[model samples]
Target: MKKVIMGNHAVSYGVRASEAKVISAYPITPQTHIVELLSEMCANGEIDAKFIKVESEHSAMAACVGASAAGSRAFTATSSQGLLLMHEMLHWAVGARLPIVLANVNRAVGPPWSIWTDQNDSLSQRDVGWLQIYCESNQEVQDTIPQAFKIAEQLQMPVMIVMDAFFLSHTFEIVDIIEKEQVREFLPPYEPEIKIDTADQHSFGNLAGPDHYMELRYMIQEAMDRGLDVIKKVNKEFEEIFGRGYGLIEPYRCDDAETILVTSGTVSSTTRAVIDELRDEGVKVGSLKIRVFRPFPTEEVFEVLSKAKKVAVIDRNISFGAHGIFYQEIKSALYGRTDIPILGYIAGLGGRDVTPKVIREIADKAIGDEQPERYINWIGVKI
Candidate 1:
């Protein structure tokens, strides 16, 4: 059914459709509406699920880890410092190999106390082993939830569906909320072979000696290696049922283009408009929207980007002492294979507007440059 809803409610609708058994999350701004609506759904019997109200994000994730370990489909949501607070438990969920799905409203970390958009919080957890999928629209945000659970259960890893703070999280959009009956056709019941069962008890996440520890870690890598194919398969099945689909990387006009701009989350929407404007001007440029960040769709990215003479990465995130987070990933993805001039542009942090003009500037700079002056360029910094 189609409904005009805020992005947060879209997440709730997704979870409801997926039939998540245990919903645990603490209320944090921009992300609070998700759990708030889920609470009402549980109260109204709209969703037959256990809603665990916790004091903090830490407890929220811990509850999800416990619930998931007990063989229940668990879910949670958070933003910014809240996600940062769940850091250790995030690893616990991964180490325990529990398939818990989380939605993180991308926000800037604070000393100045900003509660607005940026990719810092989620990208900071890149090493924590959760499969991260960034969404460009409310529909994708809603759709990714079921897909996340499918991938998580298949690989026994946690999944995070990230949306931009206000742009995609608080902003209202017309979303085709997939009904439970239809969603079930795409994502059936999640039944894992291994889960915490006291009757058939076994230790989990125990201290592993060096003799056996490395292989356990290696297994995670193996599962992640197969995850690319798993994601593709899941997307194909989801599309077969829902008639809409997305790829690991959505390359727009990249074929036969000289310069390509790379982006993720809501930024991709504006970037596309810039791409269209440039195309009208006879500029041979394109845009690549990165949907999945983890398992880093290296091959797909390489195939599209390697053909271009130059690639520009637009990040709403920054990694201190280096370039943008996605910029670093793009560099690592194409390092030795191509000598193309890869440029990094940082814009739209802390809720700053990343308008079409800003994206146009980046594209113009990329298209007209003989060689980039530096690896990373700040788009609109006052200094």
Candidate 2:
């Protein structure tokens, strides 16, 4: 059924459709509505689940960890500092291999205080063992919940569904809400091989000594290594059943392009429009939207980008001294394979609008420059 709803509610509907047994979250700006609707659904019996209201985001994630450890499909939502507070538990979820799904509305981390969109919050947790999927639209945000569950359960790893703060979270759009009945076939009841059971007890998150600790870490890395294929398989399965599929990376008009722009989240949509405008004027430029960020999609990214003459990555978040997060990843992906001039531009930080003019400027610079003198370029900064 089609319904006009904001992105937060879209996330709620996705969790509803997935039939998550335990929904636990602490309210945070931009992400509060996601749990608010889920709480309502639980109270009204629209969803047969336990909506655990917790004090802090830390406790919210801790509650999810406990529920998921007990072999239930678990979920939670948070943004910015809320996400930061849940950092310890996030690692717990990954280390325990609990398959909990979290919807993180991407908000800029605060010092002076801001509730706007940026990738810093989620990107900060990049090394943690969680499968991350960045959504471009409300429809994709809604659809990705069930897909995240399926992928998580299969891999026995937690998944984080990320979206731009207010851009996708507060903005309303028509989404073909996937009903629970429709998703049951795609995501079967999560039956883990091992879970907290009183009758058949098993140790979870137990201490591993030096002799076995390295192997346990090795197993986690192994799962992450296999993540790409599992994600692709699940995406294909979802497409076959639902008539829609979002790949790890989406390359638009890249077949015969000289320059390509890399982006993620809501920015991808705007970048696409810019690409079309540039194309109409006989400019050979394309854009690539990275949907699945974790597992990095190195091979797929390489294949699409190698043929291009220049590649520019527009990052909404920066890594302080290093460079843009996505820029670093893309450069790493194409490093030894191709020496194409891959430029990195940090734009739209702290929810600043990344308008078409800004994108055009980056594109023009990338195409016009014989060679980029600097790797990291900042856009729209005031001295």
Candidate 3:
């Protein structure tokens, strides 16, 4: 079934389809709608689940950790400051090997205080051990939600589904919403190996001594490494059932592209439009949308950019003094490969427009062999 929906609503549908047994979250801008819908569903008996409206994001994640530990499928969501508040429990969620799913609506961090879009919020938690999936459209948000559960539970690791603030979060689009029966056939109920309970009154998240700590960390790495395959398998199943397939990185017209654009989140949509517009003008350019950011698909990126004559990376977040966050990663991914010229362009902070014109301008620069002087060059900004 297809319906016109907001990104947050699409996410809510995904949650319902996943049959999440527990949902705990705080009310934060852009992120509040997701929980609101879930709350309505829970109250209306549309979903058989527990909706815990915690006072703070920290408690929200804590509740999810508790629910997941109790062998229930749990989910939660938060934005910039909210995610920052839950920083500590992030380690607890992954370290305890709980398969929790969180929706992080990306927002700009504040010194001057801004609630609009930026990647810094979620990217700031890149080291927190959660598998992060950056979404480009409401459709991807809907699709990735169920897929995230499978990935998280299979790996026994928590995952973050990152959608840009205001863009994917608040934007409306017609999405091919999956059927409930189809979703049921695809993602069955979650049953864990061990859960927090009275019969098995075993301690969870207990402090591991030097004797067993190293092995636990190693197991996490092993699970994450194996997650790549599991994710693909789940996506294949999703495509078979839903008729749509997604990947860690989605390549657009890269087969014979001379200049390539690398992007994530909603900007990829604008880049796609630019690619089509440029193609009609006889320009050999393409685009790549990177959906999965955490398990940073390095080898796959190299495989895509290997043939391009030049590459341009557009990012919505900065790494302070370094470079555009995704740009730095893409450059590192292609390091030592002398085939293509790569340029990094930073754009659209505070929810500014990353329009097709801006994308075409970037393509023009790369096409003309112009290089960015700095790693964090702003686009669509007045000089």
Clashes of each: 0, 0, 0
Model 3, residue 154: what's the lDDT? 88
Looking at model 1, report the run of 10 residues with the lowest lDDT sum.
367-376
What C-alpha RMSD separates each model from the true structure? 1.0, 0.9, 1.6
Clashing pairs in 2: none
Q: By TM-score, how accurate is candidate 3?
A: 0.96
Query: What tens digits encode model 1's per-residue C-alpha lDDT throughout 182-205?
Result: 888887787878777877788878
lDDT of 2 by residue, 191-296 (tens): 9878889988998867789999888889988999999999989989999988998999999999999999999999899999999999999999999999989978
Global lDDT for candidate 2? 0.93
Question: Candidate 3: misplaced stretches above 4 Å?
Answer: 370-375
The order by descending lDDT is: 2, 1, 3
Q: Tell me the tens digit of each residue's lDDT in model 3 across 1-383.
A: 78999999989989988889999989999888999999999999988999988999999999999999999999998999999999999988989999999999999988768889999999989888899999988898988889999989989999999998888888899998865577888887888878887887888767889999999989988887887788889999999988888899999999999889999998898889889988999999899999888788888999999989888998888888888888888988988976477788888887778889888887887678555544456677788
Query: Which pairs in model 3 have colliding backbones?
Result: none
TM-score of 2: 0.99
Better model by lDDT: candidate 1 vs candidate 2: 2
